[model samples]
Target: MTYTSLMFALFCLVLLLVYYVVPKKFQWIVLLIGSVAFYLCSGVKYILYVVITAFTTYITAMLAHKNKREFSEKLPQLKETLSADELHAAVKKNERKSRAFMLCAVAVDLGILIVLKYLDFVLSNINTFLPEGSALPLFSFVLPLGLSFYTFSAVGYVVDVNRGKYEPERNFAKFFLYLTYFPQIIQGPIPRFEQLAPQLFGEHKAEYKNLRNGYQLVLWGLFKKMVIADSVAAIVGAMLKNTSVLSGLELWLGMFVWGIQLYADFSGGIDVSRGVSQMFGITLDINFKRPYFALNLTDYWNRWHISLGNWLKDYFFYPVAFSKGYAKINKYTKKKFGKFFAKTVPVGILSLILFTIIGIWHGANWGEVLFGVFNGVVILISTLCEPLFVKIRKRLHMEERVFFRIFRSVRTFLIITIARVISLPSNIAIAGSMLLTMFGIRSSGTSFFAFTGQMVQAGDLKMYLPALFGCILLFVVSFLEEKGNSVRDMINAKPMFVRVAIASVGTVIIILFGAYGIGYVASNFIYSNY
Candidate 1:
């Protein structure tokens, strides 16, 4: 169930009550049941997908572990007498089983993901070269929510188990809770087994602190999502749907608003997820910081979707850069081109490939593919030119000045906006046209005043004002949050009565003014589609 929904909120409250009342040892069972109930509420069919994935990985890891033990037992006689070379062979044999297990897990998870998420796109492409009458019929498939997220987590767990980084979970129910935790089922910061497994199996008694802090976080996230994102979404949706009729200023405004909407929508989801988990005395990973305040693309990524970026770095970039072929190329470049160029070239190539994968991971569409390539190019160019830029700054003696820093920040934001525009477009052609229009090389009669008038005529002005105000409020709050001030801590530091009053008012505001179950219940977060 979606964390933002009333159904989920009520469900969590009931689960929380039952959890604390149950015996300490049975807490995991309570959680397992709750998770199952949560997924079943989504529909029984979706639960099958979750169960199939959980059991498949569980069985594979068990077999892999068994194989390793058997091999170790067989080599016990030689362990005390064998030479280093013989021991190496035995180790290699054991590693092969682990590798095979990981391969199977990856194959199954990716196979399901592709069939469920991209089969239609594939069939449509195939039909392009065939006769009109021979076109393939499209069939509908209901993708299980958070399949992309949980699949990655499941694969990461099995790979970690194979690598001996974490032991395979022996209890089926505990493992199931890890995969289908209600808070993270809809969207995720993609928890690792090492991070989440202990909590799943631990005895978690409810705390007053957890309740207060968790509710505060949930309320704050609601403010961002309903007050800020929903309002901006109204404008962004209108502009995008009628982009052909928009002018340059109107288009840019819409793009800017879209950027805000995306940040609020995605980060709001993270906050709500974290808060819900917190209520259960579980701490999930922090997924966002004040990314817009970042001084460069690299900084932006570090603050935004911190989990996914780290995963890509660890799983994709590191392997590519450290591969034998990559090392050989690096050594060759160092010998032929000199040390300075060699040091940077390999990493740049690896970064490009990783970012491209990042783009494709978002979707199978050409727009996403191009978006990934666009980000990769931006990051690579920034990396390559960084030293040059630093050198120029040093020569000008502007490195330490506030003005230079501000200038650098502005440049970074613009680059990020351009990259995100490419990422968010419906198709490659529209993205290309937008880029052309952005560069002012194409003449388009899209005017800001005209679009503003159109928006007012369409009854968007009333909602737009509060959303704009909310955006400003969010920025101020985020600025404080970035400075390391905790909003919850600030509220708690006040008198108890004050805290209660603030929370009560926040709840009332959310109920009266929140976007859901009113004019915008049909709208979902942008990333939910991914």
Candidate 2:
């Protein structure tokens, strides 16, 4: 069920009631049932895919754990009996086998995701090269819910287990709950096995603080989605509808709004997930960190999609960057062209790979591919030219400028926004045209004011008022956060009646100004595609 629906509200309410009422020991079972029920509600068809990943990973991890345990048990004996060189060789052999096992399990899990998400995408590209009469029919299935999320999570867990970071969960049912945790299934902070497992299995006594914080978070998230994101979606949709007639200024403005709508929708959803999780005494990772306030692309990435970025850094980037192959390449470069290329080339290459994967992870579309490629290219260029930039910055004394932070943040936004052509539009040609129109290409007689009038709905003001006000409020909250003040903490520090009054107002505002109703559903939440 969708989060905004009446049915989901009732479902959450019912589950919460049962969760706390059950005995402490049985509380986990209640969560398991609730989680399974939630998954089944999403779609029974998805169950098989999840089971395949879960079971395959489960078996692989159990076997790997066993092998590692045995190796640990034999280590002392091996050290005593074998020479140092022989012991080192034996250790390397064991590591090779463990790596192989990890790769095999990861491949199986990734294969499922590829088949369901990208098989048709691959076929479509191939069809273009063939004659029309010989075109292949598509053979892909519908993607399971949170397929990207869970697959990465499963792979991360497998890798960690192979590295002996943590032991695998022995109980399959409980393991399944970890994967299918209802709150995170839609979009996730992508829980790591270690951080989340204890919380999941441990019994938690309900606390007033948990309820208070959760209530505030959920309320704020709902308001972001319903009041700001959905409201702006209408305007952005209208602008997109008449791209042929819209001016360059208008298209760019629309892109700006798209960024806002995207942030609100994505971060809003994560807030709900984290908030709901808090109520259960399970804390998910933070996904966003005032991304727009970031000074540059690298800093921007660190703030946005914090979980996925960290996952890639830990699992993908480190492995590839530090691999023997790249190390050799770096050594050769250092010998040939000195240390700069040796250091920066590998980083540039890895950034391209990571961001491209990120792009493809978003969707199996040309736009997404371009989105990844565009970001990668920018990163590559920026990395290569960082020394030059540093020189220029010093010459201009830019760091000392009062508006330096504003300038850098705005520059970062503009770079990312220009990439939105292929990102949100998905069609390469259309995206190119939009980019053209966004810069200087425009039709005559389509004034920006007229377009704004249309979006604002004939001077009614009600159409844009809530979104404008909501965004102002959102910016204030985000600004405070960027300044190291937690708005939640601020509210919590207030007197009891004051906190209650604030909560009451937040709830009432969401109920009154929110665009959601009995049948309301969101379609433009970008991350949901991933």
Candidate 3:
């Protein structure tokens, strides 16, 4: 089911052929069957999890809507004669029901996630506290592919229904399709119900424009993942494995390369997903937008992982900011420390907490928690200092200078690189050690050239040259894309023969030079695990 796999490519080709041949009305049926088949190939046992989640949330959302309707009906009856106590009691009862329903939805989603993803981690910690003779039962469970993604979408759907942002989906099949859409199932830009469901349920006639645009996007994504990210990974893997033997300069270089590798690998997957969805006449949200070009920590967040960042801001940050506790704190700070302090400090503190939760949401490890906190701290510091920095720049008469802007951009990139190191490790101890080693405090001046020489001797150097060329190409293409020149538009502007020639050449290059088949194992998209 992985986008980069041969099997998936074959499956897509077959599906496309069948889809265009079928009547438009029956096309959805074909897609649904294909989705189920895809899930079955992933392993059948996990289908139960998907069914359980979809059904449970679907029913719960309906019930929640019914309850809200019932409460609203009684509100007018009690409006005039009801005392303050009676009104309070009635409101409290309704609130309790709403809270209970929400809790059930959250628990079901989180419980499945915990059992499938973190049960082993939890049990291992508990086993340490038991005696040696203890015979605690241990079992292994295969995590459902895309469980983290679909579950969140499902949960968000139910929550939105309860909040009145969306009406409950009355049709079970439509709801299921929303949760298990094949293209976005494995990795996602995590579609929202309001944004995506309409497209799925509405009329979708295949368009030549969608096909041309989508195919180009898929090719761009392949170039990034197969040609660029994978090659960088080989180099990074060698350096990280022998960190003890690497020079300080080598370590820093590896970290920088790793940042690029991760971005290409992840954003590449997103591009393919978006393209595939587009081919099906659905438009998924954009995920990344030149994050490295950001001029500040705040700007970096806005560009990087755009979907997840916005999701967190909407579902977590906003609620906490407007919560009673936060409101009280804001009021207190305003009265005591002034409006400027209140406006910034409350948001920074709340953002720190939300980011910490975001980190833990990524995994069941302390490393991820630390990573989240590291990012939070950087953003928080930047928020507090931004005003002062702006004042200083204005005072120095450097506010609008190009050089100052370039310096800020470089500074932001470096800060992001350091912050991402903490995010990549498996444990806080390793992350901290890596940071220390990166600073040259643990340096022994050992030669890293010898290791690089060995890599070259082993014929790994050949794999990297194409990737370097690919990276340069990717940069140029991205620059063009930033300027609003889409691949499809570029192609369409050319003569018909020219378009065909370019596509034929691109296909030949991919078949000959792309990393796949024997001797190469295509790695799964990293974000899929989340």
What's the TM-score of each model vs. the native?
A: 0.94, 0.95, 0.92
Instruction: Mark the 10 consecutive residues where model 2 has the least summed lDDT.
Output: 452-461
Over 1-530, each residue of candidate 3 has an lDDT whose tens digit, in order, gives: 68888788888889877876788777777777888888888898889999999988988888888898899898988777799899989888987797678779878987898888778767876888999979466566778878888988887888888888978889898888888889888877778999998887776777898887888788778778877787777677776566666666666777888888888888989888888778888899998988877778788778887777787787778978889988999999999999889988889988888778777777777667776887889888878888898899889999679798778878888887787677666666666676777786675356423334322333366667777888788778777876688856777899989987877876665555667635876678877756
In candidate 3, stretches whose alpha carbon ends up further than 4 angstroms from where it belongs are: 73-92, 125-140, 397-399, 445-459, 483-488
Question: How would you encode candidate 1's per-residue C-alpha lDDT over 147-184 as one tens digit per residue?
Answer: 88888888888877776786788988888899988777
In candidate 2 the C-alpha lDDT for residue 302 amounts to: 91
lDDT of 2 by residue, 264-319 (tens): 98899899888888888888899999988888888889998889999988998999
Candidate 1: where is the Cα deviation over 4 Å?
72-76, 81-83, 136-139, 446-452, 455-459, 516-522
TM-score of 2: 0.95
Candidate 2 Cα misplacement greater than 4 A, ranges: 83-85, 441-461, 517-524
Would you list the C-alpha lDDT of every candidate in the order shown? 0.79, 0.83, 0.79
Q: 1 or 2: which has the higher TM-score?
A: 2
Question: How large is the C-alpha RMSD of every model relative to the true structure?
Answer: 2.2, 2.1, 2.6
Candidate ranking (TM-score, best to worst)? 2, 1, 3
Instruction: Please provide the root mean square deviation of candidate 1 (C-alpha atoms, Å).
Output: 2.2
